[model samples]
Target: MMAERLRHDGVLVVGAGLAGLSAALAAAPAKVLLLTEAPLNHGCSSAWAQGGVAAALSADDAPELHAEDTVAAGAGLVDPEAARLLAAEGPAAVRRLAALGAPFDQRADGGFAQSLEAAHSKARVARVKGDQAGRAIMEAVTVAALAAPHIQVKTGAKLVGLLQDATGRIRGVLARIDGQPVEIAAKAVILAAGGIGGLYAVTTTPAELKGEGLGLAAMAGAVIADPEFVQFHPTAIDIGRDPAPLATEALRGEGAKLLDGAGRPFMANYHPAAELAPRDVVARAIHAERAVRGGAFLDAREAVGAHFPEEFPAVFAACMGGGIDPRVQPIPVAPACHYHMGGIATDMDGRTSLPGLYAAGECASTGVHGANRLASNSLLEAAVFGERAGRAARDERPASGPYAVVTAPELPDEALQTLRQAMSREAGVVRDAEGLGRLMLLIGDLEARHGRAASLAAARLVAACALNRRESRGGHFRADFPEAAAPDRTFVTLDRIDPAGLRYAAE
Candidate 1:
């Protein structure tokens, strides 16, 4: 079919999660057009986030302390300035969400109730009814976006390609609205799409997210950062589900234990902090224990117990529906791909290498999350950087010139499934040069047979970068080289992905 052309005289935002909504709302006085592949409150990883937003909300907590925790958890690759910026603006972001009608659990003294998770020194994660943080916050933001006068949201509009002029400046996007091809021209394009968890067979994110935004940006000559750093959640409830349900980390924060299949606690053997160690440590521990012991489980029977429903209703429902009761039994758990610590390279204000283009949220690597993300910082990054991307994009003038859409071929369902399984086996948690090389071969075979789909581009980036990085650091662990190297970040464009010549490009 011939493509339909439409011109949007404002900023175009992709994905409708926290970041996209925040960007649209922040682009006040400048009209905004937001496009999402899924309906509001679904598909996007934001609403399914069980952990709350991380912020220094209490009197004893400060942004500097929060920044310290973030930098420490990142394993030395975090941009100190970006981490400080996120930490400094976190409290205001949480308050902004609350002002939009999100009913966060508050203390008796009218303060934000906080929980301590993983690496944080303070109980600074602001939540709602224990584990409803993402849903509650997204609901409020969705309502506000719907009511806003300057924002126009179009659901079920899937991004297929990016539109760029002859000078290689991004002008707009090529999307499919209900299977009909439509070309949208805008002043600036802000990519707020989520992560690449769906690329793995076992994951905690919605299956619809396959790093298309990241791939499209790279295809349009934007730089990618740390494509090999994928974070796996340690407590994904393994109930034979495709996209496994997540058991909130707060359960461990509340004193839950990680036990082997024999019901013996095993985390103490992995790290001194045990259940509260950094997420990568815990995930690797679980992966190791599962290999030898048949399984690893989270025992919340004594921690939350009778308060399971009230404390974590989502976990309780998922367990009950899967024939496991958290009140008395341990929930079977495994390391599942949860977040991408890498994406389109962006500055603190969300500007990418290409002019007239910006990126935010999980899709953009603003250096707050270096090799591994600190727990609960995902939502904070979305709100803080998403707004910055919005304001920055609002200042762009419309590009003059005929635009061309660089579209990618689509991968069939069978090929996608094959790729997912391969990714889980080789690149999911622990990786090595041998396995990464095998994965690269498979990616090349699939691309040659199925054409270069966006999914293929995303997977190729991860495999290529993982193969090039020999040393283990944070989320990008290599079993062959299991020690830390000098701190460095990886920056590559499509043209620079020569694996034999690739190095960790330090900025």
Candidate 2:
């Protein structure tokens, strides 16, 4: 086990997507060791994002407007301060990404081209091509990071657990490289490891990212916030793909409508905004439609017509592979798990409650998203908070002391699969008290069997939280109790999981 004692300088960033790359770049002049479970360009949800980044880049738009839209979309739980920070810094983040060579679509006037997404009052999302914003932005950031002298990238290294010192402060990470565990000690660690979408049998995230980051942080006793709120994208191409390909919201933005099997537009009956409603509303509408009308579809023929392939090559290719033509007919769509709003709780500066551990990207709950995330705000959140965390980590120096690596117990394959299925069925798009209670019982059984596995730890947090929240709100919909109650954010920790009541300190 000679590989067990390697050390690194600066920060150890787990996951090498936009957030990790952005963090590495922002911590420039200081050395950074970036690790990825897959190759540089693969296994990241950032590449799968098609809706582009939300920012107020137009003269007619303002950050205050953007903040208001975000709060409205979040269904009354969005932190006002976090929303304000995201709104204020959005333009600068988009501009910086553009400066790194992101080929964002531009208007004839040379300003950034913007489009409307669901729930936004104005057309403010900056895009590339049509749905290529994620890939384009990632490509640009990867180029900059690869060229940066201070960044050292290690591909195919999967983070297994966090390494904490005697006092429970994080010191480094334990990673598995080529089937061997290696310990790398650093001053600070940033967990940017996406979300729990992959935990489901069907998702929009890469299959490999099965909530390892969230599980690892929870096992290390980190404060996990809003673990029950998982966002399901309302329009994933229902082509029988295991990890379903996405149909961009931009198609709907361009006037495409959601229809049923008989070719009838159906969203108008669900919400006044129809196709332009926030994701939670749209996802529920689609789910209800499918439950009643067999399935839902996106009709893009008149909206983009022959321009579909050139404008949105990814969606076009996916449609072609399924023997469907977006130019002629509607693309079949269904609601699928796409993002998670709950994760390691962090401040605006991306510092977690634990001293030496920080988080960014989808894995950090800065309270900006609350119960539901606004469209295209995820990429903006990653960029803005990634930079903040990087700068803060770079300014600090590690104390001089000997540190020991702490390893959590490993989970078996069967136990992991059981946990995933439980969470997917119970705490999924729609839930109820009976289902959540069954899920909590299953979690306890799995934890007892697996002896405190990280996967069980994460599953318990989600199940417990979902069981506590009695009313439907945002991404968390209850079929039995299907109404919004007094608006408030729900927070939970491991100690709060009880048979009597779910209790955590009131924020």
Candidate 3:
């Protein structure tokens, strides 16, 4: 079996979303193997991103203002330098994507068209065809990946574990392609796989992002940061979809309003900015409203009106698919787990605490999105950090030999559904000590029975972290401790994580 393995002298990247694509392109002239569980576009949340990348491309805006907004939205835990780096480098990254043929929306003056989203001080989101930015940018990057000479793409390849060397440094990946196991040895392993949104019963992410990337890194003993801060998008269209369709934040950025079942506007009651409040505020408001008013909804008729078909075609199509018309009727909405602000912690260079292992995209917590990510910043983070990780990985030296392969764990279908339900019920928007303790007990049982599936590990990390943080801030809202406390960012490695603590003593 050792002789059967294929080896590459450069980076082996797991996941083919924007981050992986950017990494592959950045590691130019080096041998790169890009692996994906689904065809390039099918499994990635990047393509489903309707909001554009946030950058200070407009003349009136500056990186300082963007950084300020980012820090403000992150609720006191944002690293100033990381936020500054994101705002300063974000414009160049957007320009690079455009150079690669991303179709950004342009104004009559031939400049990039920008829009405003929640928590931002200005209109800095660079969009494409209104709601098609993600799809368009991803399409352009995918084309570049396909044309790049150094990248070798392997679709339908599911990564099970990282291949580590005798010295505990990651050397490569152990993946299953077409139901057959394959080992690919490389100089470095980069996990750009994505977030753990799919761990919840209801999410607005791709169904496949079930905590594999974060779990694999954690299983390999990497530090996990802020795992409790799960950002729930306030407007996932409630259309009975498995992975709910998003009614993009850009709608509200453009002036859409949130309403209750009686068609009464409600956001104004929660925040002074109403529809323009930070995401966590809006999500919690919606959750609270739905608890009493039957349900919540987004009324875009007054804001978008007849322009819905032209300005937000993707959203229009989604509304049409669900037997709702955005032009006249209020679209049904719910709070769904949308983004993970917490992931395998990494630095500006995208290097994790472990040697030879790197992370980027939604899977890497660079301390930029401290506790809650600002609208449209996710794509920017992926681009800037993915390229950095790729460039850094390209310069690494290969391991002397491969590490021993271990069997990856899997939960029975019954256990998987139970885990999802438990996460959403306990670890979702509103959390309490009692619920978190119960969740920890359940997670312990699942770990004992399932042998640490990536999904289980990710769920436990979030639940344990949520239990430990007694105060509510940003995406993490503890019903038991609702008031904001002193600002503090959490950092934890696998050894320090004790779900049994309930208090997150290890944190």
Candidate 4:
């Protein structure tokens, strides 16, 4: 189908989550056309975030300490420069959101009430009422975005592909609205389309996300960094729900302990930080415990007890729905695909290899998170980098002209499901060369069969990258090669993938 032309003067931002909203707000005085696939409040993973935003807001806390903790949590692959930037600028971002009217929880002394989450060396996360940070922050940003004269929001619009010039500089985007494809010609494009969790069979992200932004950028030959790293939250409430409900890590931060069915604490045997260990360590420990016995759970009984209702209302409600009282019993738990630490490689300013294109949030890998992200850092990354990208985009003038809108290929439903199941089975929390190799072959076959839906292309990139890295570093664990190898980042572009080098036979 020929794309419909829609002209906009300022920037075109895909995804209306925190990053997209932040970008739109930062690019003030410049017109922005913000596209969202679902209703403003409903389909964003940002609203599901429970641990709150990590920032050095207390006088006793410092950005340097936060940076060190982030690097440590990332397991040696973190970019010190990016970590420093994220930490240094974190307070301002939090304050910016606060100034925009986000009701952050304050201490009795009127200071920010900061809590310590997994892997943090200090109690520095600025939370809202228990676990309401994400929802509250989004509500504030959404209201700000709606009232902004320069920002125009197009809800229920799905970004299908990017429009690029003959030399491949992105000029705009091809999006679908009410089943009709439309072309948006803009001066600059910012991709803030969240993470790849939706690509897995079981994930904490919205189902429609599915890495479309990552694939679109990659197909345009954008460099992808550390595509192999996918984080699995160690404690998602396993209540037989699609995209299982998340049990906030803040519970652990508040002293909830992980125990087996036998009522024995197991985290201490794995990491010194125990329940407060980095997510990867804790997730792996849970997976191992489950493999050995039945499954693991979080015993918040003694830690929070009756405080659960007042503190973590979301988790408390979910437990009540499952006929379990979190105040008394342990909540059944297991690891679920939660975050992606890697994405379209970008600098601190969020510029991609392709000119005229910028990305932020979970969609862009700015190398700050490295191998594993610290708890609540995803929100910080979105705010800090989203502002940077938005400002830089607004300052630049697009080189004159319209570009051809690239049509995205469609995929069969069966083929897409096969890919999701395969990824969840093989490239999930625990992995091995044999499974990863098989996964690559399956991805190749699916690509050939489905003719490359952006989601499938993204799945291929993640699976292929996971297969190539032969070490068990951070989230990309290799059971066969269960040790770190040299410790460096992995970068990939479409040109680098050689079909002949694949270990498994193509279907």
> Using TM-score as the measure, which candidate wins?
1
* Candidate 2 structure quality by residue, lDDT tens digits, 1-507: 655877676887898878888888998888899999899979998987888999999999999999999998998889999999999999999999999999999999999999999999999999999999999999999999999999999997988778787787888898988789898888889888888876776688887777778878876778888888889999999998878999989889999999998999988998999999889999999988898889899999999999987899999999999888999989999888899999999999888877889999998899999888999999999899988888878876775467665555667777767766777677787898888888877767766676766656666777778777778999999998898898777655565567332333344
Against the true structure, whose lDDT is highest? 1
List residue ranges in candidate 4 displaced over 4 A: 500-507
How many residue pairs collide in each prediction? Answer: 0, 0, 0, 0
Candidate 3, residue 210: CA error in Å? Answer: 0.7
TM-score ranking of the models: 1, 3, 4, 2
lDDT by residue for model 3 over 1-507, one digit each (tens)? Answer: 332477888899998889989999998878899999999888898999999999999999999999999999999999999999999999999999999999999999988999999999999999998999999999999999999989999998998878776677887788888777788889888899999988888899987999888988888888999999999999999999888999999999888989998989999999999999999999999999999989999999989999999899999999999999999999999999999999999999899988989999999999999888999999999999999999999999876754876335877888988988888898999999999899989988988887888887888889888888989999999999999998998888766776464655533
Error of 1 at 75 (Å): 0.1
Q: What lDDT tens digits, residue by residue, belong to model 4 across residues 165-212? A: 988899899999989888888889999998998788878778877888
Residue 293 CA error for candidate 2 (Å)? 1.9
Q: Is candidate 2 or candidate 3 better by TM-score?
A: 3
Model 4 CA RMSD to the hidden true structure, in angstroms: 2.0
- Candidate 3, residue 463: lDDT: 86
The alpha-carbon root-mean-square deviation between model 3 and the true structure, to one decimal in Å, is 1.5
Name model 1 segments beyond 4 Å from true. 499-507
457 in model 3: Cα distance from truth in Å?
0.7
Which 10 residues in a row give candidate 1 its minimum summed lDDT?
498-507
> Which of the two, 1 or 4, has more lDDT?
1
Q: For all the candidates, what are their Cα RMSDs to the real structure?
A: 1.7, 2.1, 1.5, 2.0
